[model samples]
Target: MPIWGWPMTEILFFFEVVLAGLLAGTMYSLVALGFVLIYKASATFNFAQGAMVFFAVLSFVGFMELGLPFVLAFLVTILLMIAVGYATERLVIEPLTGQSEDTMLMATIGLAFVLQGLAQAVWGVEVRRLDLGIPDFPIPWLADNLGIFVSALDVTAGVVAGVLIIVLSLLFRFTKMGLGLRAVADDPGAAASIGIPLKNIMLLVWSTAGIVALVTGMMWGARAGVQFALVDLALKALPVLIIGGFSSIPGAIVGGLIIGVVEKTLEVYVGPYFGGGIEGWAPYVLAILFLLWRPEGLFGEKIIRRV
Candidate 1:
C-alpha cells in the first residue's frame, strides 16, 4: 500500500482545492453581497437572491439555446433580471410598505419559492450546460509522476470573479450612480433627504444584485451546469455570510474563502476517519464557533442594543 504521508498528488490536489476555493468564494461573495446590499438599503435578508441567481443562469442559458449569440443572450437575460428585481421591490416589498422587517423577510422567502418553481417549469428541471465562452483547456503544466493538474475552467472562474470584484469596487468609488447607491446603503433616510430617489435607488440596488447573480450563474453553471444547484448553493452561502458579517463586502469574500478552505480540508483529512464526509457540516460548525467567540464576525460592526 502507498504511504499515508502527503504525496505529491495530494499536494497538487491541495493547490487545486485552494484555487477552486477562491473561485467558489467569488460566487459565494456574490450571494452574500446580495444580502449586504439589500440589508444595507432595506434591512431585509432578501433570501430570494439565490433563486434570483438560479433563474438568471437558467434564463441566460435558455436564451443561448434559442440561437442568440452570447452577448445578445446575456443582454436579454440582464433585462429580465432587472424586471424581476423591480417587480419584487414594487409588488412584494412595496406593498408591505412600512411593515416590520420580519414581514419583508417572509415575503422574500415566499418569492424564493415562486422563483424556484418558475425556474423548474421553464427549464424543465434538467441541468443545462451554460456557454460562458471560457476556454476549457486542461492545465498540463503540472505533469509527470506528480501529474498535478487543474482545469482551465477553474482558472477562468477565479479571473472572472476577480474582475467583477474590482469592477464593483471601482463602480462604488467612481460612478455617480454608485455613489448614490453607497449613500443610500449607508443611510437611506439621509439619502432621500439629499435628493436620491428612493424608488430608483431601490430598483438599481436590486438590479445590481441581479447582475451579480448573472455572473455567479455563469461561473457556477459553467461548473455544475445550470439547475437547482442554485438552491443548494444558497444554503452553502448562509454560513459564509454568518461568519463574514452580513454587511461587509470584503467580509463576504473572506468568509467564502474560509468556508471553502475549511470545508474542503476537513472533508479530505478528517471526514472519512469519522464516517464518510464532514464537509456538509463544517461550515455550520465553524459558524457556530465564530458566533460564540466573536458574534460580530471578523469584520462586522458591533451594534450595541441597550435593553
Candidate 2:
C-alpha cells in the first residue's frame, strides 16, 4: 500500500497514535515514580502501584459525585491519599521491618491483590462516567481540502503531562521538603542520624506518589471513563519500570515514551498480521529486548557491591 493513498483521517489517526504514545509515557512516568519512591526509601519494589493509581482515581471520582467542587474534591482526595500512605507505612511496611528486599517486594504484591479487591468492593464492580470538567471536542484542520483534526482531549492530556513534569521537577529541586526527600532517598540511615526524620520522609513520598496517581487517574478516566479498566493501564507500566531502571526518574519518562510509541505504532501498522494482540504485549516485548542489552536499564544507577 502506498502511504500517499491513505485518507487524511488516517494520517490524523497516526498523529493521535504518536500523541497517545507520548502521553502514555508520561502516565507511565507517574506510575513508575511511585515504584521508585517506595523502592528508594525502603529498598522494596511496590507492585501495588497500579492498584494505587486506580484506587486514587476512584476516590477522586467518587468524591466529586458527592457534590464537592473540583478544588475541594481534589484536596480531600489528596488528604485521603496521605492517610493511605501513612497506613501503608505503619501497617503493611512496619511489621516487616527487618525483612529482605525480596520479602518486602512480595508483600507489596500481596498489597496489590488486596487493593484490587478493595477497588471492586468500593466501586461495586461497575463502570462509572468520571468526567472532571474537561471537555474533549476537537477542531478540524485542512490539507488538500481534506480534514485532519486534533482532539481537545489529546491537547489537554499532553499539556497536563508537560506541566506536571515541570512542577514535579521544581518540587524536587527547590523546596526544603524536597531536599528532605532527597536526603531520605539517598541514605535513610544517614538521614535519620542527621535529623531528617526518615520515617516521615517515607510517608511524604508515598503521599506524593498517591497525589500523582490521582492526576493520572483523572486524566485517564477522562479518556476511557473510570472503571476497573484502570488496572490495564497500570499493568502497562510494569514493562516501563524494567526499561527505565527501578530507581531513575528520567528513566521512567523515557522508558514510557519508548514503550508507548513502539506499542502504538506496532498496533496500528503491524497488529493485523499478528491476530491484533500487538497493543497488549508489544511493550513487554520491547522491555525484554532492552533488558538483554543493559540489565541496569538506561538510567538505573550502577551499584558496586564489595564482598
Candidate 3:
C-alpha cells in the first residue's frame, strides 16, 4: 500500500489496462470512420459496411492463397472494392435516388446479406489467418523497464489509425474534392445548384468508404482470423457510432476510446462479481445512457425543423 491506500503495482497495472484499451479502441474507431464517411456524404446509415469488411479481407486472403504476393493481393483487393463501390452507386443508389431514408437503409440491409453470401460463395466458409507481419507480442523493453505490458500489434494499429485519421482530416479540410464533398454533405440540392456533380461525388464517397472498409478488414482479420463472425464486429461499432454520433469523425474516435476504456476497466474490476462477460455488453449499456442523455451524441449536430 502507498500514500493513496492502493498498491503501487496495482496502480501501474491499471495504467497498463487503460493504455491497452485505448489502443484497442483505435480499431473500433477505424470501423466507425467508415460509417461516418458515408453518412456525412449521403445522410444514410450504411448497414453493409461490416459485410464490406468481411468481403475485402476474405478476398485478400483468397488472393494470397492463389499465390499472389502480399502487395499484389492488397492492390487487387483495393481494386475490387473500388469496383464494388462503382457497382453500388450505379446499380443500387442510382436507381433509388430520392428514396426515403428507410428505403435506402433497407437496401443496405439487403446489400449486406448479398455481400456476405457473395463472399461465402467466392471464398468459401473457411476461417483464414491474415498475417500483416506485425508481431502481436508485448514490447520487451516496456515490460522490463516499466513493468507494463503493451502489444506491438496494438501499437501498430494505433499508429495506422492515427495516420489514417490525419490523412482523412487533411483531405476533408484542404482539397477541391473535399470542398465538393462538404458541399454535398451539407445539402445536395444546393450543391447541385452550384454546378457540383452530385452523382460523381456520391460515387467518390462510396468508393472511399469501400477503401476504408478494406483497411478496417485487414486490421481486424489480422487479429481474429477471417470468418463470418467478423460481420458481427459491425454490431460492436453500432454502440461506438451511437455514443460518438453517426455523422462525426471525431465523435467516432472519442466514443470508441470511451467504450474501450469502460469495457476493459469494468471487465477487469467488476467482472468477477458478475461472472466475467461485462466487456461484451457494457459499451452498449453506456451507449444507451448516452442516448438518454445526449441523443445527438457529444459532438453531433442537433437538427432543427420548422413546422
Clashes of each: 0, 0, 0
TM-score of each: 0.89, 0.88, 0.97
Off by over 4 Å in 2: 1-16, 141-148, 303-307
Of the pair 1 and 3, which is ahead by TM-score? 3
lDDT of each: 0.79, 0.78, 0.89
Candidate 2 global lDDT: 0.78
Please give the lDDT score at residue 23 for candidate 2: 65
Stretches off by above 4 angstroms in model 1 are: 1-13, 133-137, 142-147
29-115 per-residue lDDT for model 2 (tens digits): 767767776776667788888888888888777778788888898999899889888998898987987687789889888888887
TM-score of 2: 0.88
**Tens-digit lDDT track for model 3 on 114-140?**
999999998899899999998888999
| TM-score of model 3 (CA atoms) | 0.97
In candidate 1, where is summed lDDT lowest over 10 consecutive residues?
142-151
lDDT of 1 at 298: 78
* Per-model root-mean-square deviation over C-alphas: 2.9, 3.0, 1.3
Give the range where candidate 3 is weakest over 10 consecutive residues by summed lDDT: 298-307
* Better structure of 2 and 3 per TM-score: 3
lDDT of 1 at 169: 68
- Write out the backbone clash pairs for model 2: none
- Which residue ranges in model 3 land beyond 4 Å of their true spot? 1-3
